[model samples]
Target: MVQKTFGIYTTTDTTAEEERLYVELGQRHIALWTAEETTRQILAFELFEHEMSPLDSLAEVLKQVKLFSRLLDNRYAKTQVIWENQECLLVPNSFHDREIAPNYLDLMFGNSVNTLVQEQQRPAEQMTAVFRIPRNWKDAAQQYFPGAAFEHKYLQLYYRFSNDPKGIYTLFYRSHFILILVKGFKVQLLQTFDYQTPEDALYHILNTCNQYKMDYDTTPVHVEGLIDLNSPMYEELKKYLRDVSTAEPSGEWQIGSEFAQHPPHYFLPFFKMMS
Candidate 1:
């Protein structure tokens, strides 16, 4: 089957119903993201082009604007045109200049800044992931929770492992543990720890989780690391966390999604808030 993709970026919650509207209009699966609650930031839209060209998908998107507008009015209790092509979509740039500086751009444009000044400015766009869940999971989601929402972020970690030539070497000798918070379809935090023992490493992990304001009451804690899965250090971490069940590889860091560049930018606002 051929899948068509389109992205909707809006200042308010107007684009929230675009996905269902498109699906009703004979459009295949579409991935959507919103920035409604983020303080100064407005919105970001990502459209994936798979089994079709970008131009055809773009046309299909243009054709569905009125239906999307009506859906937004009936569902989210708002009436507005939520889709704009040139405003939300970003043009490729080969310039090595300051346009690539995220921190500076975010300072000027993120949710913290006054939205009224640039209410006309559209949020930037990028290509992002669209998941195909297992059939059982999909059936459960549709049956019990039809109108539910799920949000996720992506992060990258860099670790260095030390090896020894001795017969009995140490497992926790030289590895830097990192935790990243992915938000707005980008990495927001990158925390690193240099601990001496497995206990210390585990402590750092727990402390980092404590510092992060996750939905712990309902959402599960997730950890990803580059360690020998069968090593003693891994066993100690499992024991320290009270069970080996919670200590597992992160699904986000699977084979296909490996980082292709040096590293990602840091989200300063989240850190200041964390501090």
Candidate 2:
């Protein structure tokens, strides 16, 4: 049997050993790997520092994520889109049991597109594009939003960006939940919270569900991040959000993992204001 495999490399967590552990856990599904470079070093700044533009920042991050997805789809064993951020990842699957297919990713960053692309045998669009956004941002996310009205509009989303290399500290704002609409693609809604305690975050999330009138409390939602499951944040998140399913956090796409894998990889090119 040809067991499918995929890899993640990022710097969300500073721990190096956790990568191997995450990989081991993932081995039940897809074979995992990591890059020697840290994803933290790839910092993108706004086009101009003239004003505080959170929306612009969010758009920039989306672009970066989209570009990264493009690169991943351009090359890979499986022609599928991959999405990553400091907190989690989401992969599209053709099978009912999404985990069985190597169609999604966890956290990991910092390998050249050229290298990853070299491994691709198919063209883009043959695979589904992965889309992920801040779950905590849904809370207190009104500031970056634009209103959209649709009957049974079950979801919402917002986007923002910043120069802060420390992605977590940039404010997930779990107090509010917002929805994002893609022209002809998919829609995303997320909740953001301040406290590191997962219980607190989960409480806020539940509240949002009530407000949205969606039955999410018992739903098995998926999540991902780079922090060790044994850590305070991880434990808290699991306890409070236990009802939801979570993906293995991608260390390969995060800053901490990137640094652990490679401290000196050049990331200046990837982090830039696209014209």
How many clashes show up per model? 8, 66
RMSD to the hidden true structure, all candidates: 19.0, 18.6
lDDT tens per residue, model 1, 176-258? 44344433333334443556677777676566546654322332333332355566667876565542322322222111112
Local distance difference test, per candidate?
Answer: 0.30, 0.27
Candidate 2, overall lDDT? 0.27
- Cα error of candidate 2 at position 131, Å: 21
**How much is the lDDT of residue 53 in candidate 1?**
26
Best by TM-score: 2
Instruction: Give the range where candidate 2 is weakest over 10 consecutive residues by summed lDDT.
Output: 21-30
TM-scores of the candidates are 0.26, 0.27
